[model samples]
Target: MNDNFLNSANAPYVAELFYKYSQEPNSVDSSWRNFFNSLNEDDLSVLGDFGGPEWKKRPSNIIDEISFDKTIRPAPHINIESFKSSTLDSIRALRLIRAYRVNGHLIANLDPLNISKKDYHLELDYKSYGLNDNDLNKEIFIDGSLGLEKAPLKEIIKILKETYSSSIGVEFLHIQSPEQKQWVQERIEEVRNKTIFTPEGKKAIYHRLVESELFEQYLDKKFLGTKRYGIEGGESMIPGIEQIVKQACIAGVENIFIGTAHRGRLTLLSTVLGMPYKSILSKFQGYLNDPNEVLGSGDVKYHLGVSSDREFEGKKIHISLVPNPSHLEAVDPVVMGKVRAKQTQL
Candidate 1:
């Protein structure tokens, strides 16, 4: 009747003996058989409290809560040993999952050049959760945390790595809104934060990259000595901005105001804002001799703002890039002002 007999140290051995006694009474010693036969439903229910507070709160009849494989679940009654083992595994596995969600970004491969070494955190390791290689193959009940109800520790770890520690690391736990945080977690974990593009989509991205590179190359060749502040290495932003425009249009957004410094401004103006290449070339060639001929208050070529309408899949959206001076990030408030003015007009 003493609950201390079923402590963590000997619970597995006792459960094993009880299972053997249930299968064939002669398989275990007489004392073990007698002990097993003396156990009632109440004693069996006590096994639910084996793990931690989470397990302690589980219903006394844990047989319905946990799904056991045929090999582990005995004929007439549940195998208490298997249940205890799985419960402990589930607790450790849950802790591992939470650790990755919180600290997995510490070791993400975010640096494209790989110049800086990543500081790996101990919590991201399986050993930190008291798990070993032997437990990796064991299945644990996760209650659909990562779109899976029950998964092996190895599979869970694989999904966690793919979702949290890949090239794109997400840190959304700091979000104050519970709904927004859960939404972001579910959205990324469901697809492992991978976006699969179709053949046409791939081709479109390739085309954008080619356009961006060609524009930069043309500027470099045309005005050899001029300081253009070109977007040489960061050409991907052209396609990224295009995709943002398309997605925004799809989401009922009709206007987008942008602000950026000299870097990549010409490329964005020509490619994303639909500014004519001839116009940009004319300005670079010093064709604007008179002050009145220059656009946007007679500013330099890159400091000039442009407005254009772009259509994606029949949905039209107007984009406006606010001009900025030599000071970095000076146009942010101007862009916000334009957005506020547009909102007022709407």
Candidate 2:
């Protein structure tokens, strides 16, 4: 109820009982479950004296106030101080895990140029949760978090860094839907946000990269003074787009509508959208005329639109790249309208 009733002597036991109740409410007595359910976060602070020396010295005092199951009682051989320390460590570790899910993106290695400054968040540090180098090797009960029941603090930190603070950072805790948030968390944490490609897959990606880079090089040479936006530094996007298309088709997506500005548009068209290089080159050589013109006027090659069908693993998908004016993102509404119309037709 209060500090007077739940002091250092019984705090560890109560905390352990509360953790058990949290994991499985039916495991504890109905009375204890009801009492724990009634307690708010502020009220649970009475269990904060978990690792105090006095509590370790007076383990017998825990049994005086409440009758716990024999399974909840510490064995005679088990050290009370160690048990108390582990309980406190588990609580702190949970807070550290939560901090990663919420703010780890602030410290992620996302800047490819390495020019941007990243602030160090104290919340993501073990010291902020009352842990130090000495505690790193200590095992704590995480209750199946990150797919582990218990793990050393060092291993837990390593997993968290790989999952949340690596080059691919995530900030999904802000999602309003619990199911969606949980699904994302599970999916990311399951693979630690890293995708492993087979040898063949790696080769495919390499070939795509080569195609993108060579295409950019050819354009730069052929059109010396032309303002044809290129994808030189970011050629990896070609393979990335291919992966998106493959995954979408695998997921039963039948259509994809893309709208974009001039940057990398030609590269996407030639590489990802299956547009022939000869066709694109004809536009570059001024052999093609704008479809909208009655007098056969020329249009910028980048502003041309195309629709193509691609098949991946026996699944066929239609991809439509909407034409845009010089204004950025101008084709977004047109793409949306086309999508709505297609849905109505379906």
Candidate 3:
């Protein structure tokens, strides 16, 4: 709590102590609260001050800020003949009506995955299963006289499906007059093809329906659980991280610094840093355990940073991820500052 203890040498120790004691109600150590509460207004403002690299790129003042338009302006819709008997303005109004009817549209309207092999079925393979491509043939249209989204296409399909489902194992609905319901349902049955997916989709669909692909299939292979938090939704994004990185690197940045936490580090380390999987595993299993190792003490195995250079648009772009405090999102502006500094350097 003293000046000597607040030095760089003791900062890390204090950080850990603050983190640990914070878990207990009475253990928050009063000196920390006293230190924070004692900061002057000037000290506080300096601590929070931020922004301005390309600040010239921002608005000049509060009045210059762009805001969403909240005002509603509506013109009257008058019939042409009814509007015509008055003045020249009325004739103009008639012209407006004629033009509006011709173009304004008194509209009744409605509007409307690659898994890789790890036993991944190519989307092409699911052609026979009616589940995944079933709606492809239908013309999706709707009524809007009552307003928009009167009934979504999916709900309409659901209504039609339930109207006559003795087959495909869809449960039947209970109605007051079954025969009357059956008559309306019979017409729906003629148009609705239950085949939504292709044959391959149907196969995967059935496999899922029957629960055929269980944990036991890999039983012989001896599975250890997967860490599924990220490669995100290429874990089916297709050509994968290379495509993602290539897309992200297009902005005119000389060096890119990213700091995401436990999320994508392993994949990035392997793909970006060329980190050996063996080394990653060693860290995960604590095979590299040495209490005296000081740099990244008490952090998750995947929470370390890496550096590399990539060729973006024929320019060599350097990339590094900063080692962060336990605060994940708090490092975002820090990354921005570093990116701006790199730009200035260029």
Candidate 4:
């Protein structure tokens, strides 16, 4: 047979048909004979029973011939080297995109300090993935539920960059469970199309920042050099904690416990938990000291915990701060134990 058209991809099936024909041509299936006849007519002219001398000269073990072709025949149209290169390129492209999704956070602008940026080789650019400008114009299919039926690669990259490089950084790829990883990805990706916050919401966030800033500045002026453990840089924590408490209340969570070291505890207490500003000021002035009450050396005013009963979305939430030692994260176990005990009581 002329391998110009008939190659190893079809060779095994052809060999099987030839063996059947050699046994009984008339009994052979019509499809098999028709398939053989479809090959170059001129080549079939000189060939005898099995269609070609090349096939007839092979061993009687037709299975062995098919096996040999499967093992040894170089497929005519397929460029093996090119196929391997293409496969490797595809693998690298997949890995490149995955790396961007996983480690883009390493280079993200999450720090409020606006610290010096570090380059993480997320390999976001198309050329890094062996793709070019032309490839960005080509449409590619994504998950159907994503609503974006099909999008250009460039659009996908833009969405990824916008999603990862923002103030929020996603770190879900390290999640072991496939379902959990997918769930996180879906939620994070939803940010791409998430409706913009209303004007009122923006105004509220702005007000919170201003409140945080002014409170810190006031303390700085009133009590100079006195470490009130300010929330100066982490002003966003005000709105963030507010949002969390609001959501927890809406979700019907009865209690919300926050634990933090000296960094911003006082500001959070005064602002979010609604601790009395005069009382906090009195503590700073050493006028709020409990002279009668004693239990060894007491913690700093900022290290003291406070609880408040706040109503949100028509739900009552008991928000409490677990007093933390100067050692960072020391309150975590204490908070956890208290939470479990509370849950037991409930």
Give per-residue CA lDDT, model 1, range 234-324, as digits (tens). 8899999999999999888999999887989999999899998888888888786457765655467778778999998888999988777
Candidate 3 residues 166-236, lDDT tens each? Answer: 13222223345656544433443444424355786556445432322232233213424544234442222
Candidate topping TM-score? 2
All candidates: TM-score: 0.76, 0.78, 0.32, 0.67
Q: Is candidate 3 or candidate 4 better by lDDT?
A: 4
Clashing residue pairs found in predicted model 1: none
Off by over 4 Å in 3: 1-241, 247-252, 287-293, 312-314
Candidate 1 ranges with C-alpha deviation above 4 Å? 1-76, 117-119, 289-292, 295-298
Clashing pairs in 4: none
- Indicate the worst ten consecutive residues by lDDT in candidate 4: 43-52
If the candidates were sorted by their TM-score against the true structure, best first, what order would they fall in?
Answer: 2, 1, 4, 3
lDDT of 2 by residue, 1-346 (tens): 1112223444556666766777788877675666667655633443332332122222445546666673465446545555555555666777788789889888899998889867478889889877899878877766456777678889999999999998988998888776788779889989998998999999999999988888988989998888888886778888998999999998999999999878888999998899999888877776654564322345577887888999999999999998878776667888899999999999
Instruction: Give the worst 10-residue stretch by lDDT in candidate 1.
Output: 47-56
CA-RMSD of model 1: 9.9
> After aligning candidate 2 to the native by TM-score, how far in Å is the CA of 59 from where it should be?
31
Give the Cα lDDT of each candidate.
0.73, 0.75, 0.39, 0.63
